[model samples]
Target: MKERNHTTLTEFILLGFGSGLGLKEGPFVVFLVIYMTTTLGNTTMVFLISANSPLHISMYFFLMNLSFLDLCYSSTIAPKAMMSFLAGSKSISFHGCATQLFFFGLFASTEAFILAAMAYDRYTAICNPLLYPITMSKQVCIQLLVGSYVCGGVNSMVQTVFTFTLCFCGSNEIDHFFCDIPPLLSLSCTNTDINVLVLFTLSSLIIVSTSMVILVSYACIISAILRIRSAEGRHRAFSTCTSHMMSVILFYGTLTFIYAQPSSLSAPAQSKMVSVFYTLVIPMLNPLIYSLRNKDVREALGRTISSVFLK
Candidate 1:
């Protein structure tokens, strides 16, 4: 067995999507458009939730957090990716990559917790309507929001520390777009068994536990809805959950596929596309999905537009 040198690598070249794809300026333009749209959509959602009195509730509170998370999450990766596409420079400094990984992990883990909190909120609202206000009080909501961030921060810290500690002796070209765990692990010259174990354990705990919360909440919500004697009541109750459910499915489905498997088994191309969908596309879709499907949001937007025009 040969001993590996622990040479300090200062920077890494992110071979984003690779030149072999033959994507010219068109993809850059498209990504720019998506980034702008994602920013606008999420910003609008946050603004609407904040400004509208009708939306000053627990559900919307959680929603506003989600919008903010999406905005930050997309920003962490999109701008850098777009710049690489335009400038044909794929290099990212060691610290720059670490920062990206930290924030990306932070927002991503926080969003998962927020979704679970939202599911619990829905559960309370529908299943225990009489106690909903007390169950999801202002203090409780604040606690939930704070807890989500704290959990995310802790998770991000652990993963970032574990990842960057590894020795990259020779190759510094990252196969994917951003600074992610799997690709980084693939590049490490030293043994990564412990890192892989920690990655799998932490990621699985976050995803599976939060997913279970959502599943149980929805199960209870459904049971309560089914007991509603009025068809209109049942429909209305179910309608409130549809948007969150869809977002959850889209997010968790992609994330589980990408992160749950060992890095050695992941196909770089397929993983990149999946990453694009959840990281970029999902953020843009979230606001649209919620606003377009909910009449209240549409009315609120209309009111906002009319107020500005009338002024």
Candidate 2:
């Protein structure tokens, strides 16, 4: 028979909003506005990508997936976070917390892999223009996306299982807004060496693997750009990947701050702020970065808006 080391945690109290002194309506309203914007922005990107013929390529397909993930990901926490601010009760049940952690990990990791896939797409499009369509065929694109999701699913399953295995006989208050693995692990009464090692290993794999792919793809892209003789061509080529590069930077930077370290490394307040960047700010920024900065997406949105209004 298999044995478990720690008694399982039944529930966890979330320590959202840090301090609840006079934060009655303002913060709630602000988050509500932010959540609404997140939904609208991400939804618009998905709809535009699906409806526009030009955006039916591999790059836009991945962008649509990222948009979908961002929308659902933000929905998971922002509403509840706002509710916690208003209700002054930050408690989340054991099952509920686990559920949150599962989807959160699922989407966050998926985004990392999706960004890597997008980089590969860009690399093929620019570095091997003749073979772009052949290399990024429909079947290949589907597999890349499906593989990203599968990676996320497997990682989430392992991390979530190991996370919930810890005994929570003592404090239930999670020091962050959500049921993150780090903060939850910090509160466990049992030995978490295995969980910590597994988490660190899994996170390292995701971060390093995707970062390496992005770096290699960009290296090829730079080589292609340097070979082009026309200054106008170079500018146009570089502009194509600008928004995607920005999104990658924001997503990876925030993720590194949150997961790529031991809990002992960060102060509570600093951790909370970094968490807010990945959870709140990055999701909000991604759709905006793509839609506003990229002319093709902006034009697609305009056409969609006109068509809908005309009907």
Candidate 3:
């Protein structure tokens, strides 16, 4: 019996969804369209938020950050996967894989924090309407935004360093579309108990903490809305939160499913499907949901389009 060399791995072959599902061109077309839509949609969100003065408030400011995060997050995995699907080349250099892993974690974690901030903004706006302007002022919003990115960077650095430090003597074929911590940890030749523990701990802390913030904010918001005597006033107040709540549910639900459990408990195939939803579907849906459901965004979009076309 030959002992496996632990330090010889230089790259990893990502077994993309197409190969995993045994379909080539069909998945490629679907994913390509999804990628394009996500990119365009998120880009438009950023553009509209930045160019329109009416949307310069805290909610849209946080939304712009989210749009930027989604753009980077989807780019971290989607382009590589789409290229793999198109060119039938699934191999990624070790450094490239590590880079992807870092950015993916950074953007994802940052987005979670941003969502929490947005929830707090809503809470202030609805529950403490008189103080909303002071509570979510520009300086405070900037602080929160900066803090989210810093926390994300720290988290990414820790996870990337921990995951890549392990020796990969095992096969280099990752059973997913990207270089995720779980798939990479599964390939490690070293004992992965600490890595698994760290992954679980960090994931739980980020997801649970942010989710709690959102939950508490919404609880306060609901309470405040219930106090209103007029039904129309209550309905209008609740409507202001529906789009954000829907986004939070979709983003956090898929994320919790994918990251909240031990790697041993997750099936790679099922994980990939959930990953598809998280990475591709969510980003594409967020801007659409926010724009279609919110009257302000629609009016802004109409104004922006009219300005461009009329001139």
**Candidate 2 C-alpha lDDT tens digits along 214-291:** 999999998999899999999899888999999999888878877776663347778777777777777888888888
- TM-scores for all candidates? 0.96, 0.94, 0.95
lDDT of 1 by residue, 9-111 (tens): 7888877777443344766787899999999999999999899999999999999999999999999999998877766567889999999999999999999
Superior by TM-score: candidate 1 or candidate 2: 1
Quote model 3's TM-score: 0.95
Candidates, ranked, lDDT: 1, 3, 2
Q: In model 2, which residue pairs have backbone atoms overlapping below 3 Å? A: none
Selected candidate, larger TM-score, 2 vs 3: 3
Q: After superposition, how far is residue 188 of candidate 1 from its true place, in Å?
A: 0.5
Model 2 misses residue 280 by how many Å? Answer: 1.5
Residue 125's lDDT in candidate 3: 96
**Candidate 3 Cα deviation (angstroms), residue 161:** 0.8
Candidate 3 lDDT at 29 equals: 86
Clashes of each: 0, 0, 0
Task: Give the distance in Å from residue 57's predicted Cα in candidate 1 to where it truly belongs.
Answer: 0.3
lDDT of residue 240 for candidate 1: 96
